[model samples]
Target: MSRWPNLKQLHYLVALAECENFNRAAKACFVSQSTLSTGIQNLEELLGVQLIERDNKSFIMTPIGLEVVQRARQLLSETKDLLEMTASRGGSLSGPLRLGCIPTIAPFLLSPLVTLCGETYPDLDLLLREDTSDNLLKLLEAGELDLLLLALPYDLGSFHSRVVGQDPFRLVLHEKLIDSYEANPARYAGLPDHSLFLLEREHCLTDHALSACQLADQAKINPFAATSLYTLVQMVSHQQGATFLPEMALRAGILERTELVAVAPQGQMPHRDIGLVWRPSSCRVEAFAGLGRLVTSCLR
Candidate 1:
């Protein structure tokens, strides 16, 4: 018998802890339920610890199990980093590279970035995930995502980041509203309550826009929120409310078929900085740097 629990057993334990169901955990680990159960049992016997309390329908991890799971996650992340460092010694970026992006930027940059990566690094298999910044960052920390392309000035904690470009904000409103504002310039500040719409609070873009465009008052007016940029645009088209759109969205022709107008906000225009971020321990810094240049060119 080995003196320490093997990595495979640690992996199973972590997967079970995360999925909370033996069947689902087994599926996630790409193993049969019986195999997964036996592996956990063997791990328990080897460690001489009761990791979980099993019931007919569900199971609960013991307190020690929870602590072990946390340690296991860190161990797994470091192990992956070690493997990556070993592979990168050849000085080539290949194999599966999982990348995550925020919802606001994904539609505009994902396709072009994919095309560029395919052309430039044919050996690299780029796997993309579009999610909220918070969720993507969580995935990055968990080692589920290799890198992230998200708006900057965010709290990235200890992760390293590089700015790629600036995405300026534009005030998007109904053409009629634009005309009304032009006719009555004083109405700009007094724009009707609930006349400003933005994404749900979970999206960092909402905070970014509010801070950058100084639309804090406008946000106070509306209890309503849109789930996506497309929904926000539709709401504006229906004369519901105005929104602050990133320059990349406008360049992508998001408002092309609508009567909506996108114009620079009054005073100096504010913008979000686009950036790429990764764990400092990652060995793919060069690859990420090259990707930053690609994203910059795409923004151009």
Candidate 2:
């Protein structure tokens, strides 16, 4: 049987691959640069292959090195999982769990969910990342995150998802603009092209809001696009334009001081389904399901 490098050396390799600089990698690994270099060199000797191509100016991973680093990451993750499993067997559920959430849902949903998680699973080490849907999915695919909480009709063919609940949208109009919307409903049907303020293009919430409200042929929207639900509320409070928000957010005190009127859509309520997503190959499926249950319980 061939010998193998130690886990310490594998850690150094993964750090180097991520940082691409010996000094930075060493810092990340909490070791001196020389120590990191020596460890990598020893690893190379044991593996009988050069993993990195480096000079004073730059560091590049050899093809073999890239493969090694990828496998090293997986190995480390599995090692962590094994340890977590041992802890679980010992009647504990303590380990770091990286979770990603989208902007629209994060503000309103996370507070209650986090509280519930702390109360129910105090041993879980939760690390939260708030980002856009696109960015969160990328992180989930790359193994940087253990799971994701986001809204659907999102296309996630590569990931496994479970619908947790639905959050319906509410039309938020400036109090002063309410009369205009009430008196002239027909004129405002296409108001997205005229007076509506929407989340920036590419935000899934934007599409959810627009489609749910059936504003596809609306008038020209405001030139300024809000980056977040809070920003949209702020703009609607201060400006004459109207926006859409999820009911949970509005009920969560997002409209405390704002002169905004919440209106139901004319037909069936417009809403988006929220879901918990994880990679199909993830080992933490049970823990993620527990988290989903907690979220569903708290949100309801």
Candidate 3:
């Protein structure tokens, strides 16, 4: 039977893999460079394999070392979960909670929530990453994030979610376009394709906006697309284009300086569900629930 590597050694290996520099890895692990090196050497001896190749200029992990590093990350994640569970059992709310937030939601939602969390749970450690919904979900599935704050309507078949609130979409237009539209709303009915600015493809919000606005004719779609809400706002502010924004974002002062006019649709307001999502099998479900409640409270 092969002997197992100690958790300390596995931690060092993971840190080295991440940093790719012994000195930096040692600093990350809060250990002396010599101690870190000796630990890796002991780990290699115990496993009977050379895990890393080191020279003057660079450090390289062998193929086997790469595989080991992958496994080491999983082990560390499991270890963290175990420790969190233990702490929870002891009635303590302390440890690292990795969270992912979609770009559209993060700017408007997280600032106040972060302040609230800091005041409420001083012991809780939060590690935040911002990305698109698709990317965030991929990270959640890979165990890289414990929870995700996503603007919903995209399919989430295997995950559990708690809806915190709804954020309605408001029509955004350049000041000139607003005056034109107000003077004669029918002029916008046959507007040119380039007059409408939208988020780039692959974002769920783009689809939601299109569907909600009944913009099914592909020929009337905008040629210019933006990757972020901020970019879309910028395009609308500078160029003679119009777009849509979430109500919460407008309320959060997204258009404070811009000469952008926000208007609700005549009929049903277009909106998206904002929620907290987590893997159904997560042991940190309670923590996620707590976070959801806090978020709901703050939003209210």
TM-score for each of the candidates? 0.93, 0.87, 0.81
Identify the runs in model 1 with alpha carbons over 4 angstroms from their true place.
Answer: 183-187
Which prediction has the highest TM-score against the true structure? 1
For model 3 the local lDDT of residue 199 reads: 91
Distance from true position, residue 243, model 3, in Å? Answer: 0.8
| Candidate 2 Cα misplacement greater than 4 A, ranges | 89-94, 184-192
For residues 156-269, write the lDDT of model 2, one tens digit per residue. 878999998889888888777776676775645634455788899878998888888777654547878988888888887787678888888887888887778888754477
User: Compared with the true structure, what per-residue lDDT tens digits does model 3 show for residues 1-300?
Assistant: 367789999999989987888999999999999999999999989988899998887879999889988888777767766676777763344577888988788888788888887887788888899988888887776577888988877788798988888878887887777666566554456455677788987777887777675555565457889998889999888986788788777888888888888876433767788899987656777777777777876666
- Which segments of candidate 3 are over 4 A away from where they belong? 90-96, 118-127, 134-144, 153-160, 178-189, 200-204, 219-221, 265-269, 279-281
| Greater-lDDT candidate between 1 and 3 | 1
RMSD (Cα, Å) of candidate 1? 2.0
Error in Å for residue 5 of model 3 = 1.0
- In terms of lDDT, model 2 sits at 0.81
Give the 10-residue window scoring lowest on summed lDDT in candidate 3: 183-192
Q: What 10-residue stretch in candidate 2 is worst by lDDT?
A: 85-94
RMSD to truth, every model: 2.0, 2.7, 3.5
Judged by whole-model lDDT over C-alpha atoms, candidate 1 comes out at 0.85
